[model samples]
Target: MSIYLCISGIVFSVYLIANLWAMSSNRLNQPGYVLTDLDGLVGVRHNSLSRLFSGFTTLVAKQHIRRIQVSSECLTLFTDADDCVNIWLSDRYLPINANYAKVLFPQAEFVDSPFLP
Candidate 1:
């Protein structure tokens, strides 16, 4: 009986330690879609029109912007059918302000807008 009790105590301790470690190291996967901790969208009429983005889907904002900046460079650029909105990227991979982050693949542009799609 003592032996059984000792073995159970050790197993419980190991399990608790493993769970704590996982939490500390963030090994636990979060649900996809969490975006940011910034203020939500605001409108003139004070209408609720935005959802909080969070979780694993935050990868959407994880762009590897390197070397150049679009605001500094006026280089004209285009998007693919998927409209991932890549960097303007001149011949030398220079950055351009294509503003692909805000624009969905074909959200506003495809909706009879003179500026896009």
Candidate 2:
């Protein structure tokens, strides 16, 4: 009975340690994990599958990005051919810094962006 209790205690301790490690991980702070101003207008999160497709697109991609526009709550990337990708700000990520945005996206225009404080 005593040996069984010791084994259970060890198992519980291991589970607690693992849970804490996962909770404190910095995965969300990475470039592709959470959108940040540092990524500029061209940065998009890439998983394994998306990374493969992105490589192919970069190889034969002819579309040229014209400008990026930031509004109070959304970011818009414009291409020379009228194509665009929009990202909306939410509670999922922290607010963006204005200085980084300007530095990263030199061609970007802003319109009363609340996130750029």
Which of the numbered candidates is closest to the native, going by highest TM-score? 2
| lDDT tens digits by residue: candidate 1, 83-105 | 33222222221211133322322
Q: Rate the local accuracy (lDDT) of all candidates.
A: 0.27, 0.44
**Candidate 1 local accuracy as lDDT?**
0.27
Ten contiguous residues minimizing lDDT sum, candidate 1: 42-51
> How far off is residue 45 in model 2, in Å?
3.0
What is the TM-score (0 to 1) of candidate 1?
Answer: 0.25
lDDT value, residue 77 of candidate 2 = 55
Candidate 2: regions farther than 4 A off: 1-41, 46-63, 91-94, 97-99, 113-117
Give the C-alpha lDDT of model 2.
0.44
Task: Write one digit per residue (lDDT tens) for candidate 2, span 16-108.
Answer: 775444333455223343333333234443222232233422211223445656665455556667676554433223234223334455555
